[model samples]
Target chain A: MCGIVGLFLKKDDLRPQLGDMLTDMLITMTDRGPDSAGIAIYGPETEGMVKITVQSDSPETAFAHLDAALCAAIDAPVTIKVIDTHAVLTVPEASEAAAIAWLEETGLRIMGSGASMEIYKEVGLPKDVAARFGLREMGGSHGIGHTRMATESAVTTMGAHPFSTADDQCLVHNGSLSNHNQMRRTLARKGVFTRSENDTEVGAAYISSRIAEGATLGEALEGTIKDLDGFFTFVTGTRNGFGVVRDPIACKPAVMAETEDYVAFASEYRAFADLPGIEAARVWEPEPATVYFWER
Target chain B: MTTTLDMTATDLRAVNTTLQAAARAQANEDYEIINPRGAHAMACGLDGPLTVTIKGSTGYYCAGMNKEATVTVEGSAGPGVAENMMSGIVTIEGDASQYAGATGHGGLLNIKGNASSRCGISMKGIDIVVHGNIGHMSAFMAQKGNLVVLGDAGDALGDSLYEARLFVRGSVKSLGADCIEKEMRPEHLEILAKLLEQAGADAKPEEFKRYGSARKLYNFNIDHADEY
Candidate 1:
């Protein structure tokens, strides 16, 4: 089993506390999974700049002088902020492709890239992963977190959740897919390939491919219900939207709570017990095979 | 007197052990559980008379294998509430997750709100009354007991059932294989009436449609050997 938590703040007043609230919620579900933890935050967007999050096992040498190297390689301004084993590289929007290509050549794993999204994930407990990333101090408008139990893949940093295949888009899953290999082959024929052998990565790539083909977030999620064959309760985060969908035979548990301030999703209600005004929130389980989305 | 237990202060094992001891002694006490925070296995496996009221929602297996206890959840319950209960009354004021009261031998499970998939699945000698709808594949292979639903039922109600009685007041999405609607006779009406009253449901018994097994799949016959 795995645990997934997502928070989409409806009001800007709660943006500053998004990380704190999501971290607490994820920790409450630590018992559901102990293999690895991951989180994706949609923070404030800087005009003309894109953020590329990368990870390396040895950050001391991997991140050393990374800003100047990337600046020279892309022939543009670059800034790198190191946090534990991960770093967020901010560069010109036009240089995103060059920067990503240069980072890939250096053997750094690209976690995600977007104007507003920064992803941090590692092979450890949720609490430790959150602490290493200074999750409590970070601020965002919406975020998604996952604690994986490692069923379809090994317990490695690459296997952690919140798999991102597109800019400002990510997905975290709670159930395993049986037909991921088949789907992966189908996607490869269309020029969409996954980096890891993990099944959830294929799921993320599927959704991104759909969105790239001009499908809306709701449509992309509905496509999963028809195309993806397995037990799944998926929470996907885009630039300004948070979407949820469960398979028709949804055995994996999911609970959602919504207040005027925010919309929260968790594997259990225990994660929501500490939210402000939780007593007055409208809480319920999402219907199977139905797509629910909240957008600004 | 009402004894209060704060989940944040006391561990779950200690709280359950204390209640179990009181039940074994036949103390017949009343307990109030506060700040449940959706914890699993709240107030389970009692052997004597006791009244437990949980102030908030609970996680999986709340009141499982209950005996001679009246456990009430003021809020929603997670999966497998009152599972395999021997004898008792388990009540949920809010909705319940999947497989509520599954395989219970004897008990009355009352849900004021909707119950998710497989509500009362494989039930044996238990009485379940739902105030709202029940989800898909409910009462699958039910061997015995009465399941009363005041609202609609999801797909495949009472699939491959045996001897158990199903009473639905609203429309059924579809019936499962070998589970068909039977005429609501006087005895079934009486059973439904008693279960509804005990569960505090307001619907009239005459509005329900009874369903049971066609007695086709369980027994073997020489003529059906080729099909098997």
Candidate 2:
């Protein structure tokens, strides 16, 4: 079991409160999953620039000289901002691929890469993880968070959620996949690599591959009802949209709330109680085998 | 005298203690629970006659195993509302999520709005009245109870049903094994009328259809092998 949450802001005034609100919602679900926590934030983007978030077990050594090394390798100016074990590297859009290849050679794991997204996660309680990363002090337009119970994989930083396979797209899951091994093999044959053994990451990669092949987010989610096996409720965030889907049986619980200001999702309603103007929000349970996505 | 408890404190333990206290008092005690905010396990394990009103929605297992208390929710309810209840009255003013009134025993549960799948599943003794539709697999394995629905039932209604009586004013998508339509006789209408009266529903019993077990699979008869 795990807790997953996502928020897509409709009003620009609430962007600054994104992290604070999301942190409270994630913390409220601590009892659902207490092993590890992670979040993906989509902030403002600038023209001709891309950001890649990466984490390292030995941040002190791996991060040292990283900006200089990558700048020289890509022959482009690079900037790195370090926060705990995670760092966000900004580079010219044309140099994104080169920068990622260089980082991969350096042996640092790529958490996420996109024009505007950054992911941070670790093996610890959500409250502690949020505090360590100073999550509440940060601001963004849309974000998703996960607290995992480690039902299928080991409890490690790489095993945490908010898995991303493509730029500006990430997903958090609340259930297990029965056919991930087969799906992972199929994806590998097609040249899409999934970095972790967790089924959630496989699901993320599946959606990303579908989108990469030119399918809409809605179409990719609808395909899961037929292609993927096992009970699952997925909340995926792209640069401009927030999407939700559940398996046909819908064995896992999921609730969604929408207001004039934002669209929010959680494993339960308690996570939404603390949101501003929630009493007036339109609350409902997303139907099984249906995809609901909202874009700004 | 009436007491009010604001749940902004989010202290479920304290909210339940006050409910227990109100139940045992000699005088007629009334309570208003404000800002429930979808907290789980509210009004659980009550054993005394009292009136309690919750101002907002609740989470999982709200009012589970209740007895002798009249509890009401002003808004929607999450999964398993009034689950396994025994001898009480729980009223939901809005929609209920999945498994409403599951495994209930001896209670009156009224959902003014829709209830999701598996409503009144494994019911031993409960009277459930829903003004709106119910999802699939409702009343499955019910031993003894009455389910009254004003709206349509989804796929597989009354699956594996036993002893329990079902009355639906709307259509049934399908019936599970050994569960079939039965004649709405005068006695059945009379029983349904009383249930409707108790639930404050404004529907005529004669306008409904009755469903129950065919009893063919009750004793594991070998003659029904193909059907099984």
TM-score of each: 0.98, 0.95
> Which regions of candidate 2 deviate over 4 angstroms?
B26-28, B221-228
Error of 1 at B180 (Å): 0.7
DockQ values for all predictions?
0.78, 0.69
Q: Least lDDT summed over 10 consecutive residues: which range in candidate 1 chain A?
A: A279-288
Query: What C-alpha lDDT values do all the predictions have?
Result: 0.94, 0.91
Model 1 clashing residue pairs (backbone): none
Clashes of each: 0, 1
Candidate 2 lands at a TM-score of: 0.95
lDDT of 1 by residue, A41-75 (tens): 99988899999999999999999999999999999
Candidate 2, residues A116-228: lDDT per residue as tens digits?
A: 89999999999999998999988999999999998879999899999999999999999999999999999999999988889999999999999999999999999889999
